[model samples]
Target: MVLLLRQRGRLTADTLARELEVSTRTVLRDIEALSSAGVPVYAERGRHGGFALLPGFQTELTGLNHEEALAVLTAGSRRGERVFGLGSALASAVRKVVDALPEGHRATASDAAQRLLIEPETDLLSRRPVTEEVPDTTMIEVRRAVLAGHRLRIHYAATGQPPQWRTVDPIGLVTVRDRGYLLARRSGEDRTYRLSRMLAAEELPEPAQRPNQVDLDQVWRERCAQFLSSDHIAVLVRVHPARREDLLSTAVAVRAEEPDADGWLRLEVTYQDLWHAEWALWQLGTSAEALTPQSLRTSLHHRATAVATRYGHQPESRHLLPS
Candidate 1:
C-alpha cells in the first residue's frame, strides 16, 4: 500500500486491489484490517473522495535532500508533451512523489532541473494545429519501444515505395515543422529510418545496443559547424515587423535580427538544404525582399522572367498594381 502511494500519489480501491493481487471486496476487508489495527485510512462515501490518508499523516519522503527532491520534480516536469490528459496525470503524479521527498534534497533537485532545461528551439505544433488524426495507440506503442531501447518490426511506406516490414532500433523521436519523425537505426546498415512513414510497429524482445563508435551529439554539432564555416553563401532579407513575425514563426535559420524601430528585420541565413526555402519565400510573398547577395537577386530575376515568359506578355495598357 505504501509502495503504491509512492509510485502513484493516489490509488483507488480498484487499483489497490489489482496491485495487491486481491479482489475489491478483499481490498475493502484489508482496509478494515488496517483501520482496526489503528491505521488512519478513511473511506469517503462521495464520488470524489475514495480512501484518503487522514489529515496529518506523515511519511519519510517529506525529508529528502535537495538533489533527491529536485530529481523527482525534474522528472515529472520533463513530460513536455502533456498537451493531452495523460501528460497532466503523469506530471501530477510526479509532483506528489517530489512533494513527498525529504526537504534536504530540494535545492539539489532545483539546480538539476535548471541545468537540464530542454527547451526545443522549434516545435512542429506551434505553426498551427493539425487536423489529421493519428491513432493514440500507435503513438503509445512507439513511445514504449523508445523507452525500452528495443528494436521494432515496422510496416512503413515511404513516398515512392510500397509498404514493407522492416526491423529498426529507434534512436529518437523528433517533431519539427509540423511533422513527427522517429529516428531509428535500420537493420543490417549504418543508416537510420524516420518514423513518420511507419505504417505499423511491433516491439521485439531484444534490446538495441547503443554504439560506442560515434559521439552522437559531437557528430551533429560538427556537421552544423562545418556548414557554418564552409564556403556556402549567405542570403539577406529585409522584413517588416508583421512579416518578420511570420518569418520567425515559420523559417528555420541560423540568425534573425531586427535592425531598428522602422519595423524592418534583417535576417542572415544560409541555405544548406535548398528544397524548402524557395517555397517558403514564395509563401511570404511581397512582404519579404531579398536585400543583398546579388547572386540571389539575379537568380530571382531570372526566375521571374521565366515565369512571365510562361504566362506570355502582360496586357500592354493595364497596370498590375492598384492605384
Candidate 2:
C-alpha cells in the first residue's frame, strides 16, 4: 500500500481495493493501521482525492525477518553479476535492498553478510575459477532476443577459429559454473553458444521458431548426453580406492565399475581423445593405471620414459646437489 501510494502519488480507496483485490472496508482498516504505526498516510474527504503518503516519505520493508534479510545480502555478494554483465545494476539493487530493511536489522544484517564469502579468494592454497568477460551490449541484446521470441544474428568466435556470423533462434539462457551460455538452435539444429565468445549480436525482425513450451533442464541433459557420445574414446582402468573420486571427476563418462580383488576400483571411462585420456591418467601418478587399449599404455610409457631421461641425467656440478 505504501509503495503503491509512493509510486502513483495517490490512489482512490476504490482504485486501491480493486488493484489489491480487496474490499474498500479492508483498505480503510489498513489505512488506519498505517496511521497508527506512524506512517504518513492521509486521506482527502473530497471525491477528487484518495490516500496519499507525505512527500519524502518512504517505508521500510516489513516482509523479511533478520535471517531472510541476511540471506538476501549474502546472495547479493555472489559473482553471478559479473557473468551476465549486470554488476552495476546488481550493486544498485543490493543497495536498495539494504535500504529497505528495518533500521534495527539493517546494520546487523549488512555486518553479518560481510563476514560470509561466496567464492574463494585467490590465494596460495586455492585458485579461483576464471570468469569470462562478456560485453554488456551483447548480453543485453541476446537476453532481449530470447525473452521476446526473436531470431538473433551473432558473430561467434569459436575456439581456434575466426568469428563467423550466424542467425540463431533464441531459446533460453543457461549459466553453468559462472559461465553463461545461450541455448538456441540454428537451421533446426541445437546450438549452444558461450556468451563470452560472442563478438557481436543483434535481434532480428523475424519471429523465432521455437516450441510453445521449453523444458531447459531436459534439453540441457539431452545435449550433454549427445556431446558425451560424440568422438570419444573409451578406456578401462584400475584406480586406487582413495583416488576414485579424482578419476570420476576427470573422466567424461563412467561406463562401468567394479572392485578388483586387490581392493582397487576397475572402471571403464570415456575421454575426448587419446591425449585427454593420457593427460588424466598421468595426473593420477601411480594411483591409476590404464589397463586396456595398448596404445594408451604405450603412450604413457613413452612420455614417462622421456621425463625420466630428461631428469635422470647427472648434474655437471656436484655442488648443485642437495646435501
Candidate 3:
C-alpha cells in the first residue's frame, strides 16, 4: 500500500481496496498500523481525497547480508528476468539492495555476482540454448494480470492454427527450459498457453475468480502426467549396444528390455505418438531397427526410399543448369 501511494502520490480508499484486493476497512486499519509503527502515513477524508505517503517517504529492505544480496543479484541475472518480463523491476530492486548493503560489502557482492555465469551462449558441448521470443508489450500485460489476480484477454496463435482472441482467468505463470507459459482457466477448464504465442494481451478490470491458494508445481506435474499418458504409441526395437543411449533418450517410456542372442539389445518402448515413435526410430539410422508395428517399418522404408531415389539419378527432376 505504501508503495502504491508512493507511486501514484495519492489513492482513494476504494481505489486502494481494488488495487490491493482487500476491503477499504482493512486498508484503513493497515494505514493506522503503519502510522502507529512510525511510518509517515496520512489519510485525507473528503471528496477527491485519499491516502498518501509523505513526500520522499521510502523504505529499505532490512537485514539482508552480503551473501543473500549476492544471491538475489545472481538469480535476477538469470533467464527468468527475460522469461517473466521482470527485467526492469529486478534491475531497480538490485540497485536498492546494493544501496542498502554496507559500502565495504557492496563492491564485493557486485563483483562476485558478475563472476557466476549461467546458461551461457554456448554450453560446454557447443549446444546453444533455444530462446523463445515474446514481445514485451504482450508479456508485460500477461504478467501484470497474473500477478494482480485479474482476468486477461489475449490474441494468441498456436502452431499451425489461426489467431484467436481468448479470455482466461490467469492463475499462475511458469518458465521452464527458457520458455514461458501462462496457466489459466477458460470457461472452468484448465488451459496452458505459451507466452511466445501471445500476439497481444490486455488486463481486464475485473478480478479473476481463481482459488486463493495454489500449488503451482503440483499443477504443472499433473498437466505433464496427463500429456505423457495421452496418445502413446507402444513399439519394440532392436538396438546396437553402442547406440543405446540415442534410442532411449527420445522414448517416452521403456516398457521392457532384454538381450538377444545376436548380442543386440531388444527393447520395448512407448513414444508420445506415431510420428514421435517413427521420428525417434528414424534418427537412430542403421544402429537401431524397429521390430514391431509394420506401419512404422513401412514409413521408415518410404522415407529412406524417397531420400535414395532423390539422390539416385532420376532424370527430369534434376535441374540442368547452363554451363
Estimate candidate 1's alpha-carbon lDDT, on a 0 to 1 scale: 0.60
Worst 10 residues of 1 by lDDT: 77-86
User: Which is the leading candidate under TM-score?
Assistant: 2
Q: Give the alpha-carbon lDDT of every model.
A: 0.60, 0.82, 0.81
Task: Look at candidate 1 and tell me the lDDT of residue 119.
Answer: 46
| Every model's TM-score | 0.52, 0.64, 0.60
Ranking by TM-score: 2, 3, 1
User: How does residue 10 of candidate 1 score in lDDT?
Assistant: 54
lDDT of 2 at 113: 80
lDDT of each residue in 1-323, candidate 2, tens digit only: 77567656789999888766679999999999999999999998786999999998976654544433433443443455566555544444555566676767877997898797667666344656667888878988987788789999999999999999999998887776677889999999998899999999999989999997999889988877787788998899999998897898689888899999999999999998999999999999999999989999999999999999989988676565678
Better of 1 and 3 by lDDT: 3
List the candidate 3 regions with Cα displacement exceeding 4 Å.
1-78, 232-272, 286-323
TM-score, cand. 3 vs. native: 0.60
Model 1 per-residue lDDT tens digits across residues 1-323: 64355444456898788766579998888888978977777776666656766655655443444433433443443332431113333444545565655656844675676687454544454644442233555566676676678877778887799999877776655443334556566754443344456667787889875453445455445445654665554667777777765665545555547585566777877664343455455567777777666766666667778887988966568667977
lDDT string, candidate 3, 1-77, tens digits: 76566545789988888876689999989989999999998878888888888886767654555434433544643
